[model samples]
Target: MAAVGWRGAPGARGLGGTWHPWGASGALSVGGAWAPVGCAWRPLGGGRLAPVGGARLPLRAPERLWGRARRKNPSDPNVEGKRRATIMKRVHMARKKGERIPVMFDEKGQPEGKHGDELMSWIGVLAQEHIPIWIQDWRSRDLDGLKDIIWKETITSFTADESFWTACIKSCGEAAQNFRHDLYKTFVEGFLKEESVWTRSQKVVDIYPNIEEEDWVKFVQYRTSSQFQQLSDRGSEIRTNNEYSSRGGRDGYRKLD
Candidate 1:
């Protein structure tokens, strides 16, 4: 990660030959006569040729030059980390290559918004039922609270079986608004609004015996906001539009654009 420069031409006269330490020995050839002499020589590790007293060095080592080119540019590390994470997430979760998911379209062969209503309805149900449970889950650090609330609410309201709830949370991508999109957003916004609940709950659990409530809340909020709903929406839009465009629909691109 470090580069050093030295000062002269290789195999040239007066300190321009291969020099070694230990005895501070140097080799020089004058008029085809070779000679060895002892001197103080420090090996400048980076591939540069240095003059004995004051000579301009020439850059060497093709590998080092290429490595410098590949090194990441100095800028915002946070932005770089987020971008790298996003790419890895997509690659890890992507479906099999060359395998296509069927497209749903209207009779006119235009891509229809098939899942928007279903997605919105799911969001509404989640906003009403799941949100409260999620809040309580944060407040109480209770998995049972989330389970009981989701069961009572989604089951009774929609008459959905266990399969529905399981499927909803599992394949969040299938939901109309994409659970990743809606749920992550809701969680981030909710956490921002009521971060003290999470912090206090964690404190009560003795997870971090000495963590200050305000400091804990601030830390959690920072992480949550960095990977929130808007990112999910952006990712989903890109994915859905790409899928639609592959099916020959300009409409999807238009809508997403």
Candidate 2:
């Protein structure tokens, strides 16, 4: 808290003049004189300040008053989540009205704003809407089916033959694969290593209600197999030996300052 004093001439010092506090020093300029606040406004004959009879104001830093500084990038996860939801709502509304869906790409056939985040949001919504498709083992026919689904659902200016369409499918496939691995790691692998198989299975099913019991059982069996264990071990070894490290989090350079 800081105090402010009214500026008055020597003969009229401490009069009923209104006072205002400004700046970090709690000083205000009146006429040609600077009066330091947080004190009594006594005219020391030459505009010198003395501490007394002043009102205190609560001083707060900008960050404390306003909370975290906003990130500039729209693609930042905090911002992009709302943006994606809004786009999804527009898509639904356009469908209901029997109109062409809102497009993410510009007239020049390039994606608007942050393309990487846009593509991820599209595939993320697609995966969420079509959960059953993601749970299955994909074959060539399945990939083609997913490609068709992406082409129909995602509103982009890119044509069917364009590389951008293929890139969408590829990105979606990678995201789906990562999603499954993350699910397994978070739900299954998180159980105590020493716990019995039955106990772990029951606990996993209890904690992760979204996954069907049958699917969980099958997934557990596959993950526990010798082939899967060997692959996991190989991957661990490779990662352990790797010398390279990322400079930032999963978003990497896309993460805003």
Candidate 3:
């Protein structure tokens, strides 16, 4: 014993050689250099500390925060997302309602009239009837006879009015010198070329039928007599009640009733 103080127990002894069973180690040794015992002296290991017990810390990147948010609730109303959903709903509704979206046509095939409804209606009616046969019977001619019939009809119809005849001649001016040439270039010319005995011929007959043969002969004789002097003499009287109702006033240019 260096300096045995006392022995409190059989084997426990103090630094002074005294027995003290309750004393720790060697009386917390002072002097030269004291060394810590047990875990108190353990290194912190590069300043890294283990997490205290409880819930584990999340290991996620900054971008992943949004992904987690979406997954958790998923009903967040993003502006862009809501706009796209609304557009899709409208498209679906239109489709379900059988709405026809208007399409613009190329210049060459553009339709005439208000939304082409009038033309379409006419076409539907023509499709449902035997317009060609009706036209042939009305005209009293085959396909080959339409040219003469049309010319004669136009001439006879306008021959009575000196004003109309003078107007045509004045409007046509130098072109009237060659009547055939001027007539050939009229809008009716294009129609005659495009329309056949089967299509527009029937439509024409349905709209404008020839007068009775007796009436026609009388009209022709009246037109041809003395350079159509009969028309000059009674041109005003020759116009029918229907014609008076039609072309008698300022609204003469309107469609026939």
lDDT of 1: 0.36
Cα lDDT tens digits for candidate 3, 82-103: 4334434543454577653232
Better of 1 and 3 by lDDT: 1
State which candidate, 2 or 3, has the greater TM-score. 2
Ranked candidates, highest TM-score first: 2, 1, 3
lDDT of 2 by residue, 166-194 (tens): 55565555555555565566555656374
Question: For each candidate, what is the lDDT?
Answer: 0.36, 0.47, 0.28
TM-score of 2: 0.46
Off by over 4 Å in 1: 1-123, 132-145, 170-220, 223-257
The most accurate candidate by TM-score is: 2
RMSD of each: 22.1, 15.6, 43.9
Q: Which candidate do you rate higher for lDDT, 2 or 3?
A: 2
lDDT of 2 at 68: 24
Scored by lDDT, model 3 comes in at: 0.28
* Residue 143 accuracy (lDDT) in model 3: 34
